[model samples]
Target: MNAEPRPQESLSGKEISPTDPARFPRLGFLLGLVVVYWALYFVVGAIDKPYFYGFIYGLASALLFAICFFTWWWGNRAIRRSEKILGFVLIVGVGVLVGKFSDRTVNFFPLCTLGLPLVATLVLGWLALVKRSLISSHWLGFAAAVALGFGVFDLIRMDGFDSSLKTHLSWRWTPTAEQRFLAENAASAAAVKPSVAKTVPLHADASTWTAFRGPNRDGVAHGTNVPTDWNSNPPQQLWKRAVGPAWSSVIVIGDRVYTQEQRGPVESVVCYDAATGQQVWAHDDETRFDEAVSGAGPRATPTFAEGRIYAFGGTGILNCLDAETGKVVWSRDTKNDSQGKPPMWGLASSPLVTDKNVIVYGGGEANKSLLAYHQDTGNLAWTAPAGQQSYSSPEIVTIAGVRQCLMFHDFGLTSVDPATGRKLWESGAVMKGAPRTGQPHLVDGNKLAVAVLDGPGVSLVSVTKEGDQWKVAPVWASKDLKPEFPDFVVHDGSAYGFDSSIFCCLNLATGKRSWKDGRFGRGQVILLADQGLLLVVSESGEAILQAADAQARKELGRFQALNGKTWNSPVVANGRLYLRNAEEMACYDLTPRRQASIR
Candidate 1:
């Protein structure tokens, strides 16, 4: 003690004590690293694909930064080492546990989202409270911080955030809101007025939109009659109804609209009266596939062809149901018969119905991934090899004037003869981590446009046959317009889609971006080729109608369609526009006379 007192005045009049420590140096370094790390990560979103995992990682870094700051701020004080270590361990361990248990329907990840801010509140509060004892103040600060954090999260997500978390923790507890509201009100709507049962107007005698994208599995709604303006004469709200959580799009056939949803533990194949928004029928299966990011329910749209609905659940159950009443005609579980397991995100491929068979892709590599069942019977028609399945639905397109089934799997693009299941051609393009969820867009006769999450870019390929041998060669690749789940449509030699979160257009011939604007999250688009209108259903639930022009982007009109992150594709049948998300669904009458009647 005497020696220390002598050194206190010797070192340039600076205090020399074992307990005293400088805070700025260590604190500054840690802050600098946190700033730089976040800056780089922000850049990653702009250049590469913007993902949900990236947001999670950013939150983790924020929590780590808060911990480091707290450690340094209290280093010079009389702090307990055991308490500090225990606090950090609890923060990390609790976050990991929360993530591990969270699911699409029942979400607890909000706790982890608010974790760092809560930690900051505790640390700052402890530092400010000078009268109390260090140990008591620190513990008190933590309790207060947690309470404040919960309050803040609840305030931000006032629309059923607590209920969602409760449902996740306890499966028996049903989260109530619009989903229940719509279910209860649907009966009233049906009782008030019966559905007219009108036939969907046809253009060029094309098939009804009974599949994922449209009749051809392309995003084009041929010969549609949509109004060009929504300023003075807005769209007439035919009906707005509540729907369960699911990314499946609405497919219209005759007077019914078919989709898939999660009703508690059962995955339901639901059909509603298109005119009245009434629940016509629903067939339930004791299967549920949950993902925290994508939300719960089946991801595949129910396919309707020839008075039958081919419904595929997220858990790999393929059921062929009767169109009139939702009764199971035939059922098969790909997970049971096929050797492959469900992908991390679950089975998302929509069933493709051909003239004689219903085709779907799932597990197994050796001719088992792509399973084709006979249309009339449930017997296996054929099987083809798809390296590792992607979430993308199999599409039937006539490439090189030959009818073949095209599938973009984890490996790359694969084309197989639909009748024989023979591999006609395979592309060298590879996808890593996230699967290809976007369906391939048919450019022209034999050309194709493929967009995956993190591929090299939006790739253009032409399938040609030379002397009975099929070949797939790339025409161009553009990194400027990379789509994750948002599918692009090629109209008049131009491809349009959401480039990450921003909507972009690219020249199909040159593979050069024309312009990118309108940040619409990961939304979906449908082109009314006859009207030259592109109906864009934004992820945040806005309907934007833009001119399908290659020269420049022209947004003509816009309206609020729904209220959530909408990944489901919009459907336009007759003069009615149908839109939905995980929460609700709406029908807007795009008929000119109906639109004029709106006040």
Candidate 2:
């Protein structure tokens, strides 16, 4: 009939055939579906609801796997069923093994969650191409191509990608500059002479930051003339020093700067000269707390009051130390008193010093959820029942003429009398089991602006007293601005802070967004009320100064303040700007006159 079939013209060549023309259109449709599904998945995942984010991403990844498997089946029909099944099993099994044990810097969970299916598709395509010699294996190749393409696309779209992505991409990579600085500083800290307490005088009245988030636990910087224009005259870098891993902000009292950090395996409460950045004195305890995302070190900023520093460690250790000497006056293990384990993030609540007691969130579901210890001696003053734990620090605010400490617990917000630890008013329905990390901003005398990691963005709550009972109810809830960790400040009848790392402002009365702009990552902000400016320390390590106008965002000036992740809040004491993270600490002179002594 036809010429005798050549050895080269075998059944494999004719039967296998090129990727069918009819199948090409279907393949294109499936590829488009994969792209569209993931695009919407990413958009939904970034909406700030943790549970919804988990669900959408999980569903999207699963669907992607199914679609890829379908392509494999359509393309590898020539391969034996056993061979195809065996290849799939072998590829997925090896992928799971390697993905689980791989260096986590690249994000271990995501690699496995997104990589296993990709490897399966790739290996299946390889088998069809090289082993079975199926011409239609090109369809499987398309599936593998889609997997590889989206894996990178997803990584780039992650939150905090610009600043934190490098930390994830590199394998066992180290910041050589930061490491050298820490090493040198550690050597210097060790060789430093004894503290000359009598030589340096302490000015108690000169304290600028006596507690966390400034005086009143509000993110307001008073009497500060923050430079509006940094173009011609930039802020001076007065002092730069290396610090250990910690998210604790520096509290400046008198001539010393107090903060807690992890010094290797020890949790250290340190004091440095505010003006010179010299290590004054440091006290170390044999304790350490570690986490993957938050990293190692203390979370709560040290509280300075009554010539003593009340320091709380991430491991639940509370110490009352001498402000000048860094010597432990008294210490208490809060976890023991509460009979509860440390929180997932750690005991991040800073010690709240009142006129009579030092209040801290113990998070113990028993009667010891909120514990108040005597300020001077670490003796138990009072213990009260709070629902569960909260990472937010306790704050003393006067609501409806009643001075109570507000504790945003895991269950909801609870206000208790500081002296007796008596629950004055509790708002359990304000937020559910979602984490309440943001501080409740007092909108006025009776209303509070509260935000959480889940639910509606922010809610305005009104506290009013009808006879002996105090009732707290939501006035309005808006899905405009949701804060993750950084606190927002209310100014000119509006609240300003990061709405999932995007700087935004919301009208307090209506709970509606006035305007949302700027992408500052999940960094902290300080309200320069005196100057009508918003000083934002971006998570990308830049200090940006913007106007507090609700009409529109106007970025006046910006400067690179740090080189790494900066979640630590910026402190403006007198005219100096102090900023630090887990790795380093820096001080900048914000006022026109440079080198003003931080005395």
The sequence of per-residue lDDT tens digits that candidate 1 reaches over residues 1-599 is 35443222111123345444321122244445445654754565455345544555656765665566566544623334454566556555655554454433324544644445555555445444532332333354554554454434332322322101211222323544435755665566557665445465311235367788887878888757766768866688888878877889988876778899887778899888877777877899998887655557788898877778899899899999888867889998877656777787788889998859888988555558888889888788888877676888889888767898988887777888888788888885555444667888777788888875226568888878998998877888779787776788888889888887788889998989999888777788999998778999887799999998887789998999898667889998867899988788888888766433321
lDDT of each residue in 403-444, candidate 2, tens digit only: 989888777788888988888887745454455687888877
True-structure Cα RMSD, model 2: 5.4
Q: How far is each candidate from the true structure, as Cα RMSD in Å? A: 5.9, 5.4
Error of 1 at 341 (Å): 3.1
Candidate 2 least-lDDT 10 residues: 157-166
Candidate 1: list runs displaced more than 4 Å.
1-49, 52-117, 131-207, 364-367, 594-599
For residue 349, what is the lDDT in candidate 2? Answer: 90
Clash totals for all candidate models: 1, 0
Best by lDDT: 2
